[model samples]
Target: MRLGSREVGYPHLLAAALLVAMLVGVGVGAGTSSSTYGAFNAAWDGGSGIRGVASDAGAETQVVYNTTEYETVDPAGTVAFVISPERGYTDAEAARIESFVRAGGTVVVADDFRPHGNDLLARLGASARIDRTPLRDDRHQYRAGALPVATRVAADPLTRNVTRLTLNHPATVTANESTVLVRSSNFSYLDRDDDGELDDAETLQSYPVVTAERLGAGDVVVVSDPSVFINAMLDRPDNRAFAAALAADRQTVVLDFSHAEERPPLQVALRALRGSAGLQLLFGGLVVGAVALVARRGRLS
Candidate 1:
């Protein structure tokens, strides 16, 4: 084709097509995400803030897409964050996590309004259980009653420099065996009926929002609300401090997304490509061909 007295060769046209296709692929991969709590998601409710927090604390951060990776990771210097899993964990997967914790790995289970969290706790033989009921505070709240503030922070490594924690639609943690690190104010009450009020059945009292318990040589820290580590809530000073504390002294921080509802398509595709030698070779050949086409067109020009 002739454009303003210049001829566009077939090689040039083919190279341009390849480049445009590559650019479109890259754009689509970056713009699409179905995950809610995905570490790669930069949206408000995503856990991307916690990933930055871990990286800022000088910890090597990674995301675990499969529970099989749990067996390969070194437990001694690692901390795993299992937050708001929408899917239930398998018996073997739960056992794998339990073994990871028992073998001296720190596992932080931050969940609310999910039966899967309690199920995993039971599987791990943890004494702490997450109450599914939503805890609301009328007095010590952030912007609304649903978003309560926990002023009672205990002296612990996880609660260091954290005077108050802001929670979002959180549940109360009940633990007879674990050490309570943070608690809601006495004005907080469990919204059993979801009426958003202090009803006749509900009474205002302090409830545990964060707890830590020792299992073997490792530790299991449970946060009643996973949203505390999300991008929206991490803006709160105490929440950010609390997230930093989770990665403190840990060499590796892992965001466990094995049980999550959605996984990033780009990450999934990359993992699949990495595992297949044929795919890699194919992509390499295509890249080489595209370069060769451009070089040939330049020579012809």
Candidate 2:
């Protein structure tokens, strides 16, 4: 069972160990999830995971796997929170989402970029699009980070118990809708130039960070920042209060993961780089080592 002066064992064991290692790596990767860019179900991590404390609603939380599956949600019985959904929603898919709100269900869609899942907002009769610029309020924030601290909460029912919020790289949510639930402080302004200075071209006034609108029979709440739901921000100020307020009226909560960019041409290349490339290197090493070991030993004849 030993070779190479008792330094090597059966070649088969080495091969088997390699296979098991690869499988274990894949399983762990799938379970914990990588929080690279488009991650939403990252519940185990505190930096990018929302499951830290937000996942403890103690209610039936279902993730919409596909656009068609979103139809199963009962408008009057669920509080669906779609956070920063990737772009592209078919006409039918958009209609179904709007219908959920009209049916007296509370649909909170928090987005941060232009034309990126803004189709649903358009479907709900709102013409506003999310700006990619990171809104900041250095005067009223936990630290000098890009996160904006919203101190001026409106007197709406949604912000009833909530006083201040710690938003992570929030975008400005500008809409014709007059019911703005939360606004960045008077000193806060969009750093469009990214120079850390408020210029004359930029309006030195309060902008909407969260806005609510009425559609048909239901209502839609839009927040500028989605990072508030992350575990890292839950303990700050009244973030938990805001999160609790959103889930208060509904019997169910649906976190839509299907809306993200699940497949891209670039991702195929990345997978090959990680999986195939690594396997090739391992195969080459095994082949070279096997030939050397066999050459060093004489035949059993």
Clashes of each: 0, 0
Candidate 1 local lDDT, residue 296: 84
Residue 99 of model 1, lDDT score? 92
lDDT of 2 by residue, 1-301 (tens): 7654444557878897999999988655654434422334345322233332335655456556465655777777777777777667777877777777778877777877646546778766765556668787778777763777888888877776898888877887876753788888888888888876667877656778888888777778888877777666767888888877776655567766666655333433444455487867877899999998877664531
The window of 10 residues in a row where model 2 has the poorest summed lDDT is 44-53
Find the candidate with the highest lDDT and give its number: 1
Q: Mind giving the per-residue lDDT tens digits that candidate 1 earns over 38-119? A: 7888888777888789889999887888888888778998999999888888899988999999999999999998888888
- Give me the displacement of residue 153 in model 2, in angstroms: 0.8
TM-score of each: 0.88, 0.72
lDDT of model 2, residue 89: 73
